[model samples]
Target: MTGPDRTPPPGDPARDGDAGAAGRFADFGPPRRVDGGLKARSTRGAIGVSWWSRRFLEVLESFALGTRLTRGRSYARKGQVLRLDVTPGRVEATVQGSRAEPYRVGIELPVFPAALWERVERDLAAQAFFSARLLAGDLPAELEEVFADAGAPLFPSGVAELTQRCSCPDFAVPCKHLAATFYLLAEAFDADPFQLLHWRGRGRAELLDRLRALRAGATDPAGATDPAGTPEPSGPDTGAPDAAFAGPTPDVEPVPAAGAARVLAGLPAIPLDEAVDRFWLPPVPLPDRPPTLATGPELLLRQLGAPAPAIGGPGLLERLRRAYRSFGRS
Candidate 1:
């Protein structure tokens, strides 16, 4: 080899071939063109369903792959990501690009061990607010705190906790394909925060069932809670009617409908001054005022007539009463 002192010059054909190949390699990077046009975006601007999900995307953007993540936002909105499937510790997806065949993307997140979930479930069950919300088909905002207290974060905090793979020529860990999938998952999390929990391996049903069991076991016989996580009344379930249901006592004659109608009809043609006085001076008794008007059972019937009942059925009166009571409170 030392005998080959006569080396090829820099402008040799072999050198040119090497240089040209390098130039061509650079040119053949990830596709920048579109095929069959870009998909229509489902959402405008940033993509996310809830604050937590938005936070998720924010964290993702902070990664070194910021540029690719930004580009992926458009792909996410445009529905370029065709399929997204999530399982315990993994997310798999297909994303359409300039190529005829869609790119494959995968993401893997840390799976909370079963033992950790047991500790978390116990902690969640201890917190009435969390248990109540979870039972009512919701993920409490306070869940983050619970996880923090447990010393186990529920969401991935950084790239080290995540594994991303994309079947694209780009060497970036999270290429555009992966980014699109991430955004889609963000929106999914928004619609149902439990989806995030599900991504971590425990589904809403399983978590709820476990919570219910834990709550029941932890509940003292003296202070048990109903299935809804509300404390049961201390006394026996005395099947007696509620005080509100006691009704106008048996001895008190019911106000005849005719009488109520006449009373309503005769609501004095008082001048504005008298009407104002009647309204403002609660202490002073008005002449023809009926007691039933105070409790307002027939208030709806008086205002809306029989038509409401006729159209809404027997339950309508109770609903209307509740509505009127709510309005009064407001």
Candidate 2:
């Protein structure tokens, strides 16, 4: 005699938990069409173009959601996600599923505390390379390492770090609707890694501003006042020469103190009244010819690598290369 029928009844949501039940789910059917939805830039293969975006997608795929991720990728490509908003500690989206009304999905991640971000900003500002690249709107590859060194990882370490929710009736933690949002979100990250940082509780402008302040403070420590709000005693007028030069010139190294003194001593001493007529003029005659232009106007592009996929990817680099060459010629 057959044991008591153990099969779950038809249309039972419990079936979603069974092995390979995702393939048999009726709601897994085609999602409703969406108009003017935020479609992923990548049509096939992987969704993310940048290393950081790929790292995020890699962490999500590691969860082994299996067919759910696949269906979500399909939804992303089909533009089934109507809206996606990423804010501090959270990502919210509206995804069109097989139902009449769209489903709301949200993915939450831990935000670094202000103290931790201050530490991170200090570390980032300490590294000139990091600060320069960030100011130039490029995410350096070592940026995540800097964040990790600050005791706060730049990306979610695992599934446990993320809290996912969906309005869909599917019993999965990340239903297809949420998965679709993930894929699109990866594309968004690829477009601007700052979005990932913004979701971590610090906006791009704020982070950059903090970095600038930290760098400036490091450069001019004497300008900083004491905790008691007392101004430090002024030093000798060593910077007078710099002030006389109308401020430091870009890419020009400052002269050593001894070297500057030697040069100053070598100068023919003359009365201020006698030198007034030629005081603004150069001590020596200027070079007759200007310096030759550096070759390879596209060198910066080569250093920066490919543009974001959302911004035309390789094609943009090629166009920029041509434009640079044209400008150089002109």
Specify the highest-lDDT model's number.
2
* Best of the candidates, TM-score: 2
Candidate 2: which stretches are off by over 4 Å? 1-28, 221-330
User: Residue by residue across 66-119, what tens digits does model 1's lDDT show?
Assistant: 345666777776667777777878888888765567888888887788988988
Report residue 90 deviation for candidate 1 (angstroms). Answer: 0.4
**lDDT of candidate model 2 versus the reference:** 0.74
lDDT of 2 by residue, 206-251 (tens): 9999989877755552433779997664566664543323544343
With a 3 Å backbone cut-off (N, CA, C), the pairs that clash in candidate 1 are 41-77
Residue 255 lDDT in model 2?
Answer: 27
TM-score of the candidate numbered 2?
A: 0.62
